[model samples]
Every structure is written in C-alpha cells, then in structure tokens.
Target: MTGVPTGWRNVLPHLDYDLPDDLPPQSSLSGGVKVNLPLELLRQSRSRAGTVEIPGEVLDQYRRYRPTSLWHARDFGEAVGARVPIYVKYEGANISGSHKLNTALAQAYYYRRAGVQEVVTGTGAGQWGTAIAAACAVFGLRCTVFMVGDSLRRKPYRGTIMRLLGATVHSSPSGLTEVAAGAREGASGNSLALAIGEAVEYAATRDRTAFVIGSGETYSILHQTVIGTEAIEQLAARHAEVDAVIGCVGAGSNFGGIAMPFFADAAEGAGPAPLLLAAESSTTPKLTRGVYAYDRTDATGFGPREAMYTVGSEFAIPPAHAAGLRFHGTAKLLSAMRHRDQIAATAVGQVEAMDAARLFAVHENVVPAPESGHALAAAARVATSGVSDREAHHVARRGILVCLSGHGYLDLAAYEEHLTERLRDESPDDDLIKLATTALSAVPIEGGHLRVP
Candidate 1:
C-alpha cells in the first residue's frame, strides 16, 4: 500500500482573514450544556501550524484507504469537451465509501483517549453516521445517530448500514429528544440542522458521550485535509500542475479537504495558487444567495451561534437525491474565505448536477454521488462557459482538479430517478427564503458579517 500522509494540513493558519468566533453552546434546558468536545480536537481547531501530526492509531487506520487514487480523467474531459488537463481525486475508495471517515476515525481516537465511552452525531445523508459507527466500532465505543427524516425515507439503506455498524439510529424528530420532537416540519419535514440539534441534545443528556460533527466545523475540516495533502503529492508525481481546485460544498468538508492545500499556497504566494472553487446545490444556495450572518447551527437554537453564509436554520430544505447538500448554511470557514475573495462559490440546479454525473458515469465508468455531481457540473461549466462572470475565481483554467467526494454505487436510487426523468427539480422558494432569513436580524452580525465582493 502507498504511504499515507502522516500529518493533516491545517487551513486556519493559511488564511489571511479572520473567521469570527462562534457563540458558545447554550445550556440545554432539558439536557445539560451541549458542548463536550475532545481536547485534541479543540487543540486542532485552534492550531495555526502548517500541519498537525496524525495520532499513531489514526494513521494506522488511514493506511486502510489513504492515498485514494488520483485519476487523469481524460475520458471525462473529452466527453465534456474540456481543453485543459482534468484530474479527479476519488475519496470514495475508502472502506467507509466517503470522506467523512477521514475525520470519524480521528474523532474516535481522540474521544477514546479522552475516556469517552460513546459518540453520537446527526447525519443528513447517512455517510457521516456510517463513518462514525464504523469508527466507534474500531475503537470499541458505542455509537448513535440522528438521521434526517427525508433522507431516512429516501435512503433507508444508509440507516441500515449504520445499524449494521452497531450504531443506534433514530430518524430526526423521532420524539427521542425535545429538540427533535418540536422541530418545525419544513418542506422535507426535517432539515439537517434539526438532525444535528437532536444529536446534540441526545449527547448532552447522556453520560460519557460527546456530539461529534462530520463537517462544517474547523476540527473536522482539519482532519479531512489528508485529501488535499495526498492530492498535492500525487499530482506532482504525475508532473501535473493544477490551476483550479473544485469540490461540492456540503458544509465544505470535502471541498476544504481538497482545496485548502492550494488555498495555503494562494495565501502564501507560492505554488500554482489555484482558484479555490466551491459548487453548491441551488436549493440551498447559501454561498450564492444568503447573506453573511450569525445564526444557530441547529434548528433548536440551542447550539452554537455560528458565523456563516446561511439561508436560515429554519429554511425548508428541498427534497433532493443529494441529501448531504441540503443544509441551509455553508461552513463558517468557507464563508469567511468567500467573503474575503480567497474562495469562490457557485450554485447549480439539481438537473444540471445530475446530468453532469450522467456524463461522468458514461465516460469514466464511475458514477459520482449526486452531491459530488455539483462539482462535476461546475467543472463542465468552467470548461464550456469560459470565465466570463467568474473573474473573482480566475480566468485561467490550466488544469482542473475535481474532488469526487464519494462513489454513487449506494446512490443508485437517485440515478434511477434521473434515468427515468422523474427526478423533481425543486428550487428554494424565494418568499420562504426571505421569511426564514428574517430571523437573522435578531442576531448581531458586527464581527461576523464580511462584505462580499
């Protein structure tokens, strides 16, 4: 097996601008205070180093599937009519079949060392839940997951996988916690925020269990930097230089994982200085349409008040095959960078994303997860549409590097919908979006809101 990256690259130290501090976790009325983070994770969150050494155990586990293949993707580029060299880093090659496991294993290692016997978290599409469950099993810890209701229905297999991994899974708003039970039924009946709130509440009340996030948070993003670290080395080995780093933005973990190394170079005026681009779903276009604001990280308003580009925690999430991208808020770190022009983001419709995946599958014989398809669509958009409106990102497209966050094998249901042309292409309601965002006025945005160029 190829040697795995021993150190995880840190993105915080590479950024020039400051991401405003989030409000501390509020004391849960029914279940004690919410935050129970591990010490190492908190340290990593505050780290400003170029790289943090991976724990020996975590490094050992990563050997199972580190150095995921970086493909030339010539067939896909030709099919899309791309002129530049196109490459892709496939994160789905791991046993967990997604990038979430990168952080899951690390968190489990830290929590186990910290004497935490159980770990719990919410999942939008089930990948995070499965990763955590598998990690907990490896570390001999108990696991629990709160899955979004819509996703639970659309992808029951995700829940089944978690259960098989020894996780106790509950559908969000399942009456297990007040936060879940009282959550407003939006378009999808449950949002990612609500599921996360339930997990927080569940962890808060339980003894020796901590709520660990898969994405959107700094620590999680740090752990995921292995993706970019490996990609950089592999591309250099192939004598390829990248000018653009693209990935889908589902809380920005996968995007940050693959782009942050290039982002560091851009900040330091070194290397290729690639254009860091994030592709997001139109239905939850926080980076594209929502204002920079301070808002609760969950539906219950009991979690931390995070500074991010948000459509509001209460925004009704549209029911889409890419459940992972249905969250209302972008990651705080990504939002801050976008505001400062260090990163660029664009949103595309479900149909466009799905069609891009179709093109990729036909040419490359590897179906991209519907969430990752957004990045695929953006790559095609850049290749075909030219850099007319994206001057902020870059005009140069020397070589395109796309992060195919996961495999679409388990997401065949979405493909079936796309093939039959029965997939509902739903966009977020403007009126509802306005109504939902109105609550942001209640939160102070002085330090949080940055002017977008």
Candidate 2:
C-alpha cells in the first residue's frame, strides 16, 4: 500500500493546527487527565510523511486479513437499475466481522509498548469492543468495555464474543463506576457519550490503565487509512476510477480511512477529487443540522475541545436501530472538511435505510450492519436519481464506491424489529436540542461557527 500521500498535511492547514499550549492542567475531572493525548500520536495523525511504517508485529497480525477484497457490485447495480457501475469494499470478511479491527490492533500494540496493563474503552454496536478485546487477547493485556446498554441488550451475542476473547464488559450507566453512577441519576439508556464518560473515568482512576477511543481521534483515524490505501490499489489494478466515494459516518473512522487517501490525491492535483459523501442517521443528524463549534467529545465534559459539527455532548439522542450512528458529533477532520464544502452529507431515516439494506441483501447475499445500511441507502439514491448528469461530460463512465463497513449477522434483532414494522425513528425533541445549544454556548471558545439557534 502506498502510504499517506507525501505532504498531505499541507492540504488542510486548519486541521493541522498547533496543539493548545494552554491545555487544562491534568486532573481526574478533565479529559485526557490520566491518559494525555500523546504528542507522537498527534504528530503521526497529522504528519505529511508519505507512508508511516507499520510495525512488524502489527503487520504480522494484519497478514491474517490485510488485503480485504474490493468487489464490483454489478448485481446490486442491476437491482437498483443504475446506469453506472458500483463497487464495495466489504470489511466484514475479518474475524471481528468489521473494519474496527484495523485500528484496534494498532492501538493495542501501542498501549502494550507503553506498558499499559489494561485498556478501558466504549463501544456503540460492540464491534469496537469485540475488536479491542481480540487485540488485547493477542497482546496479553486486560480489556474492559463499557458498552451502550441498549446495544448490549439488543446484541447479546456480541458481549458473549467479547467475554470469549477475555474482555470484561459492562452496560453503560450500570452503577459500576462514578461516571455511570452520575449518569444513572438522570438517564438510564445507553449512549455513546455516556459510555465514553464511564470508560474515561475508569481509566482516570487506575494506574497502568489507559483509555482507548474507538473513533474521533487522529491516531485511530490514521490507523484506518489502510482501508483507503488498499482500495486505491485494488481499483488501480482494474483500471477503474470512482466518481464518488460513500461511507456511513457514525464517528467517521471507516469513511475517513477510505476517503482521506483520495482527498490527498485531490490536494496534489493528481486527479479530480471524487465526490466524498457521508451518510448519517436522521435520528442524530449532527452533520446535517448540528452547529459547527468547539465542543467536548464526551457527555461528562472530559477531553480537549475540538472543532466539529455537533449536537452538543449532553444532548439526549433517541434510540435508533442503527445505534452505532447515534453519536453527537462528527470527527474533527471530517467536520472541518464539511464546513469548507470539501465533502457532502445526507441523512437517511431508519426505515429508508432498512429498506435499502433488504434490497441489498436480496442481491448481494449479505445483511449489512444498520450503520452500513445508511451508505447503501445513499448509494441507491444516487443511482436512481441519475445525479451523474452534472458530471457526465467530465467523465465517460460514472462509478460509485461504497464502504460496506460491516456485516449485520449480529444485528438480526434490529432487522426483526424493522421487518415487523416495529422500528420507529426517534429524534431528539426540539426543546432538548435548544437546551443543548444553550449549554454549549456557555463554553468560552474562539473561532467556532455556532449555527444552532
């Protein structure tokens, strides 16, 4: 794989901004108190070096499933009656059944080298937890995952898998930690923000334990570059070019991994930049309707503030079938790009996404995770709309590459709800959104565009 494009850091100066010298002094209540954001991690995340070398140990693990297949979805295209071809990189082929493993192993390796004895983390749909658990098993470290309670209940087998991998799992807000204790005073259901708070608290209180984030970090996103790097090479071998690259955006890991390399190509004037499209849940349409502002990454107000499109860290999101996409904020890099109109985004309702997933399953013979279904739904929209007319003159053939981030075998319960027409699209109340906006305004930050009223 050709490493990240040389000088890619120069493409987005805003994203590569200098780290805040006045970071809050380390404290248990503050974000990154016990586990500070390592300078090396930040540097690597924003480095322009063309090809950060993968460690031999990490490469050894990657050999088990490094080069995931990029398949031409001719059958799906035919089913959708698309005039152009469609391609998909199936990330579910791995043992963990998702792309989460790509970054998990890298993070586990780093923590192991740092002499961390245990890693605490949060998971939305259990994929990240399962991946980390497997990585920890490989590295001989202990793992504790605070899983979203609703998801844990819905996908019980995922927790079982984590246990089998020797990771301890708990339901978020389970009265096990101080953060969860506080969270339970007001709310009870699982949310990404709540789980993060618990995980951070767990890490902060322990020695030789570090908090590992699943997404919304530079390091994690960089590790995910493997996806895009591999896809670019696979596409080159077939002498094909994509007109658009689409992926579902929960925390933007998979999407960023697959799209950043192409973004680098665009930066270098190598070729026209493929249209970058992010599909988000209408239930928590952070990209579509949230404000672009400096906000905390977790519900408990821990961690360095980042500039991103957000629905407020404290905003109570309604439960949706696609639990993974229920995050309150987009990744900072993706947020910056969207703010500058460098990429496009759309929100899809749960029913619409489920319908698209069913159609795809009929043709492709794979049930997509609810989160991945968003991208499939978006791709179907593009194919049927004949949106290629705008760029038809510039390119002879129109093509789309959608990242099927994971399989839905473990999410059959969600499908059952959808099939029974019992699934409901639950959006946060307007009043709650207003409350969140007001709370966010209290934070003193400069250079943020607060679009929310």
Best by TM-score: 1
120-218 in candidate 2: lDDT tens per residue?
A: 998998899999999999999999999999999899999999999999999887687766766744454658988987888888887789889877776
TM-score of every prediction relative to native: 0.94, 0.90
TM-score of 2: 0.90
Worst 10 residues of 1 by lDDT: 387-396
Q: Candidate 1's C-alpha lDDT?
A: 0.82
lDDT of each: 0.82, 0.78
Candidate 1 residue lDDT tens string, 1-453: 246889988878876656777876544456565446777788888888888999899989998887799989998888888878789999988656789999999999989988899888889878889899999999999999999888888778888888898999998877988776576656534588888888787788878888888999888888999999889888888888878889999789999999887777566777547778888898888887777777788877767788888888878777888888988888888887876767788887888899999999999988888998999988887766644223543444578899999988878888888889998777777777778777674324445343332
Per-prediction count of colliding residue pairs?
0, 1
Which window of 10 residues has the lowest lDDT sum in candidate 2? 387-396
Candidate 2 whole-model C-alpha lDDT, 0 to 1: 0.78
